[model samples]
Target: MPEPPPLTNHGKTMTSVFSLLGRNENDLTAALGWTLRSSPKFLAALTGALSPAPQARTTRIDLEVSDQLGRTDLELHGADHAIVIEAKRGWLLPTVTQLETYASRCGSAPIAHLVTLSDCSPDWAQMHLPAIVGEVKVTHLPWSVVGERLASARRTSAGHERLWLDQLDIYLKEALRVVEVNNAEAYCVVISNDRPGGGGPHTYREIVEQGYYYYPYGWGRGWPAIPPNFLAFRWEGYVQRVHRVLDYEVIPSLQDRWPDIPVLSESSGDRARSDVTDRPHVLCRLGPALRMDPLPTGINYRANRLWVLLDQLYTAPTLQAAQRESQVLRGDAVADESASI
Candidate 1:
């Protein structure tokens, strides 16, 4: 038999955090168990989400409850449900039949769910999940949805309990990085001033401040076939930062004022107002401003630049790192100012 690769330090840390055997104990399955046992607020949230009857508390929280099939991550007994959760930190999605086995083992419990850090589940799981496995109603929840529920629970919690819940939120947001920024259908538009009439950074900043995104009516076919929550990047000659994360309403024609238009005229040295108005234009509402720097080196600036594909913008590594740094910087600044005072 071949030896499996040793767990990395980070993996070990995750195991320690999630395991049922106290903080020093290393177990990958501890997190759900600990939260359910220790955090009353979280338990309440979980149970409420799982069932209508709120679980005030649980009598038992069993970790790695096994059946003929496999071990479940955490099993909460003596609550509103014989709730079984399979928590996964990485992208490894659960098989539908595997979940069905856990659900079957849950027995008379009306609610069972699989919680994972992945943004989505597999196609087969998606199609087959929520189906009854024995009497248990199976549910699939992503970490972000779970985090929001926990956050709601945190408000009602207090002291150390609240502190623990807060820690869970931080863990979900930072350690897990499970909070998805874009919808599954959302896409990227890595556009720059590719033509004589295309806008620049000054125009990009104006669009950002004004809270509207504009494209010339004659730019392309009727509204770039993209879903809402699409990202728009501004390539400022040197670097590309996210100009806007956007959701749009089509203006149909330049004359339609459903979404307010920018002041322009035939005198702007672009297309004639009358000439442009004949074509449909997109009146997009700008979303959150993001700051990401130094995208994948040597991007193609010509040919297909209008719909330049940069899927990594959804992850936006630099922006997230910058945001974290800003939080720390703000805290330090506050401390310095307080000391000076």
Candidate 2:
């Protein structure tokens, strides 16, 4: 991976700090947040759409299909998605060289679409993208439309995207075990910089003091099964309550617990708006945090699909087939082979 672009400018302007917020992450949450209640196609494709967003916190594959002649922009592992973007930017446009490199990296993954934020020839994107991404639906929105400028890859002081894959593999193992709609562990959001009210983390600690999350008694996605004994954070003027506060030991940083990244509060100018909240905030008390601004209600987080699947599977009359299928499906039997059945 190429080194991350240095924060350009003499480090002036809110753009240096707030520009990340403006970067078009291709985030489904944010995109839908902007487009939903209007575009039904986007609404239907919400989950997958957001999956490719930069800050999903979901770790993915990395490949930069460089030309035999030269290396260019990076290509994250992207297949089985509906869109592919050849938005090959920076010093490598106006030719098939960059596109070929990216397409090479695309090896074997089903291509659904391609989009390019770069000012490549329309003929190039329109004609070549489908072939390059192979079946991924292709659309090249201008960088102005996609909202990405200033290109480069993530880097650490160690240089390069220096994450330990071995650690990530273990993290995924633990995450898979707890990612189900049922039996999910609680998530913690940091408040290190907040000017807390009486509620905040103290409320969560109080809930923990009362044993709210004790041994499978709690639920996520909605309000805490127990109330009045919960904690709430005060932002602006709204009081956002915790569903189940926990003393968790997530192997990765606490940031990974929530399925999404927290967007910045337009009202507050903090470096980050808030933590990716564990469960959606319960409206146990509402006056303290910003009220007019509502929170998201996502059923995917420990509320919707998996438990329903389990309930029906467990109750099916043909117990043998369901059990066998469950074993194959859940026991790490090959995903492709298992899906065929």
Candidate 3:
């Protein structure tokens, strides 16, 4: 029997095995466990990130280990420390009971830690999960952070180590939707009216005609750290227009920023009671709307604010198609000309 070809070799001809295997929680856990077991440097980096103090050397990597409480997704048994991991798909988090149960399995190791890996943000996870379950310290690690750390580790690695880390990083971003906006070559922000159907000053029509868009500062609303090259407006279940970002400014109020425009002044009056008119806002000035087909929004699309690659948004037939195409272009799957969107 011949030895199987390396994972890197398969990238040119077929979709990544990691991407295919990562479709479900169990499979994803197995894939991650395999990576940690195969790559010593990656494992060390992960453990170091998980622990404040240096972790004891990992001696074993176990998957779906059975116990009285439940089966843990993955476990790293170190010489003096033990780490129990519960992997969840999508934005799901492990139940409190599940976390406590897994924490119990950590035993008498000097450093016992319980970690949950999912698409949910770390802050969100921290709010939901207990800081500590018995003697075991608990924490949430977002897949996005894992992907970023892998990319960072890969930068200094060589040979097979670098290749494996590269594939896993791509798998996390492409298949799991653990994307980092900063990594994109060129991306656009898609914004929608706070109240889509309700008559308002910031209506899609008003924004298009006025050639500007503004979002209130802070409170989970703001622009990306990396300024987007384009701004897209979504309304009536479609992305109606995309505009090149001409310029932007942080202003105390809409009136302060563009008092000369009567429509904007009227908008300021409408928002007076809400205090939004007086609050600081990121006022983004934009170029004329691009002439293109309106991309129909998908049923699963829920975000009022989201980011999409500029090229993908322009080239894809639908909003969903744009997202899928972006994943493929990022190396999540093999690009097939005949493949249906």
Candidate 4:
């Protein structure tokens, strides 16, 4: 667990809860430059990507070296190579003319990289820039890719540098909605039915009609860790069939407004607790559902938890697959509906 920050920096309420990236785009870029300058391995990786080169030596590493002409966001200069970076945050896309302006001023630099949080590359960025900029090979980087690099660097960093990199990593993870899972790549998660034989809140029929699903996180059960971006729904005691998969976001019930999702009350002998929302509930915007035909036999009901790996479940290519599976499951559920007339 993270230690609570000093509540008051000299008898005042702490205003900037987040560090560099949270403040603004300029700060994020500047921080990146600072981090790269401190780490020789990262600096070499950035330079090598632009063009072929030998191993970069830390002795020659230079950050923000004399960009008086272009005023680029960052400049990593070395003895025989250099890279000029124009960093962007959020949806701010650089135009062809703007890139051209920067490239022109780079003065025969080995690489001119236009990095942004998203893919804002129009045709001209890829097709026209290389020809116009001459020797400067142009490239685009999404925050996701950059976040991967930061994560790698963090592992080898030390002391204050590692702390700063960790802060930047936090910002990237939040913005990118990527989760670190099972010592593997940062990926999404899937929710498994607590009861292996099905019969749970938000059934297949319900999920198909609703377009979204919500499950309270950490409800004192052995729930698996939730991923950063998406969620998948799986039925236990069955052949790895994924009924639905959707991109999801976490909503803090205490601090943030609840999502406007349909609430259905389906409890036995009591008023349903639909309206009493919980904090850190995952709301998955429903997507494709897949079914496993000819259900495998000899399956055992084990865990009473819902955390599942997203890739392990099977996803159907079409709604027909979901419909076909739902019909079968719904029939079984109806037969088991003891309250029916």
Deviation (Å) of 57 in candidate 3: 0.9
Evaluate model 2: give its lDDT: 0.31
Supply candidate 2's per-residue lDDT for 6.
Answer: 66
**Each candidate: what lDDT?**
0.51, 0.31, 0.68, 0.45
Tell me the tens digit of each residue's lDDT in model 3 across 49-122: 77664456788889999967789999989778889989886556788888877877788988888989986667
Per residue, candidate 2 scores C-alpha lDDT tens digits across 1-341 of 99666665446332222233332222222222333223323323322333333323212322233456554232333334323244333212334444444444445554333445443335434644453333233445543232221111112112221222222222222322223334322221212233222123434334333333221112233323332222322222222233423222211222232223242222434432223233223322212221223222221121111111232232334322333455555564433212211
After superposition, which runs of candidate 2 have C-alpha atoms over 4 Å from their true positions? 1-14, 18-69, 78-93, 112-114, 119-138, 147-341
Off by over 4 Å in 1: 1-29, 52-57, 89-93, 110-118, 121-130, 178-341
Q: Which sequence of candidate numbers ranks them by lDDT, best first? A: 3, 1, 4, 2
Arranged by TM-score, best first: 3, 1, 4, 2
> What are the RMSDs of all candidates, in order?
15.5, 23.7, 11.1, 17.5
The per-residue C-alpha lDDT of model 3 at residue 253 equals: 62
Model 4 stretches with alpha carbons more than 4 Å out: 6-22, 53-70, 110-134, 175-341
lDDT: which candidate is best? 3
- Give the 10-residue window scoring lowest on summed lDDT in candidate 4: 332-341
Deviation of model 1 at 244, angstroms: 6.9
Model 3 poorest ten-residue lDDT run: 332-341
For all candidates, the clash counts are 4, 23, 0, 2
Clashes of 4: 2
Q: List, residue by residue over 124-185, the lDDT tens digit for candidate 1.
A: 23553555555566666665567778888888889878766765565455445332454332
